[model samples]
Target: MPLATSLAIFQSCKIIGVPKSTRCAILRDMAKVRKAERRPPLNKTHKLKRQDWAKKYLKTDFSKVLWTDEMRVSLDGPDGWARGWIGKGQGAPVRLRRQQDGGGVLVWAGIIKDELVGPFQVEDGVELNSQSYCQFLEDTFFKQWYRKKSASFQKNMIFMQDNAPTHASKYSTAWLARKGIKEEKLMTWPPCSPDLNPIENLWSIIKCEIYKEGKQYTSLNSVWEAVVANVGFKKLVETLDKRYDFPSRNHFSRVCLPALYDECRQGVLKDLANVKYFATTTDLWSSQTMEPNMSLTVHFIDADFNMETRCLQTSYFPEDHTGQNIAAGLRQAIAAWNLDEGKLICMTTDNARNVTLAAQLNGWMRLQCFGHRLHLAIGKLDMIYGCNY
Candidate 1:
């Protein structure tokens, strides 16, 4: 039963002391919340086919194999879900499902030998028919990886994809034949078995990363960017696994960290080049360990007039929190980014003497944050009112 029902029962018995949290705790000790597992529908024939395919590939070498698939990401949250919390052993809530027509993008990608193939964004409104699928294969495979490998390598390599209509079409088969991809080299995938495909796991990881923390994209372009970023990060992790046997924490900090930072810094600088003016905000804070840190964030209106914000840097400041040192640290950050001082607008910060002095030292106008002022005002009111409010 739902927690509300239990709460109502307790209320009717005049057990007001048992709050919602207590009820939830009592429920948790007896039951668990679990989402239903999703699986493709499979009949007896499909199950037999899967078993046969599994037996056939039990001893096959998968090191030289490539897996490919296309996935669609929706602007709406992941696969539509509707449910009311119920106790364990209760009948599952019926899912409210609907056909996804628009507001999503389809992307085709592959993974082979610790390397990522094309995260090719399929054109909107275009169906993935036989001819287009063949074209995609030709472009991503033959034109790139296949062309670069030796005859022996190509001969031993296997191409694997799901049994979608386009994959089994006559045109696609003829195209593969022309490319000298024999039946022995083309893996015959079983129906209703996505668990066997490693690329599906990769896709799941990418999706989880993309939609982590309930992230929602406002634009398809942002979705594409996220896809690319997550895919690229996956490739990087794969490369790290392949090259480094056992890299230490210091190794990553000394080597990989700088490379990633430089790449991001360059990208930010390229975007900033077009902007004539931008505002910045800085704040000083301490970690749980009380280690001092300062962060700077840049805000600018892009070409589309959309207000874009970027965290320029968060730097450790072990030095004294004097105005001169703060000013020097800000100057150092500005110099590192190669930002033009003349293009700088006003700086925004809380009413901190050191921060204001730092702005003065940098010869920039400062804007006091109204949010901080309000917070201070509220604190004073609470002090004056005691428990009355």
Candidate 2:
């Protein structure tokens, strides 16, 4: 309270012997003891949220975060204070700057542990409201970062943005919900805490470099040039890798699907070569196009005594499924696979009379498929249960 108000209150109470001067001194001492008020300090909730995030993802690969943010660059020059030293008599340099507003342009960007992408300049006079920002991300991140890498690389990745008003707005959250990103995945940020965000520091370094060496930013095009020119991508990648221990692109490729595919292919070929004989099962089924499709699948035991199955063929079987026609089709498929008729142990199909007759004509031991028999058995059981009940 003010000294005059304190005095008036004290005098009105009429219970104190202390005079106005004494009251003034007391108020002065209290003011001296009190701390200065600061604006918009971090609260306990934000602190606890940050602590929880750290605990949950302390060892997380930061490389997966597709870090995105908007930066405003003033055409006039960089904002904020700058200091320097001078000789006793020489006048110091005066760079009077204002906060970014009208003359500046808003730019969007996406970054990761392995890459520092974009100075993706936003259009002039455009505001990235909730819907607009989501569209921007869909355009940039999906088309650029995601398409550049394999799906395996994106398994651990997520889109990260600060909790700006638009980013946490209803439209943006709804869009993210539609994409199956829930809770912390989208709103995983605390208020006014830029130090926790590495992109903020990245932007700081970029801004400093753009205005260094007495450079002048005259237009949006020049500002874009300065931003892109100053970013030493080679060094940036190296620094991020060194700091976060991220893998190089080549090393990353080695651990992805292509390598797994090659290994699986080799293993399968080696197993097939060792098997002396195999039985095959064939079936004619209607495809999504409502046309008849025939599939031939093989079954055999490996050298390890483990049973394995592999598909040999799936083709458009001829419409004529008569005994002679089906026999010819089965013979052609068996011959195409280089299986000796003498070594062919057996063949199985549904209990269709024409298929059985075809097998007998082809001179292969014919058997009914156990799966088709079991399906028929289940239908009989349903009738038996209905009659008994």
lDDT of each: 0.80, 0.71
Q: How many residue pairs clash in each candidate?
A: 0, 0
lDDT (Cα, tens digit) per residue for candidate 1, span 122-156: 87777889998888777776796678988898889
- Return the clash pairs for model 1, or none: none
lDDT of 2 by residue, 13-45 (tens): 784778777777876766543434644467898
Error of 1 at 153 (Å): 1.4
Compute the lDDT of residue 131 as modeled in candidate 1: 95
C-alpha TM-scores of all predictions = 0.49, 0.47
Instruction: Tell me, by TM-score, which candidate is best.
Output: 1
What CA root-mean-square deviation does each model show from the true structure? Answer: 13.8, 23.3
Q: Which candidate leads the pack in lDDT?
A: 1
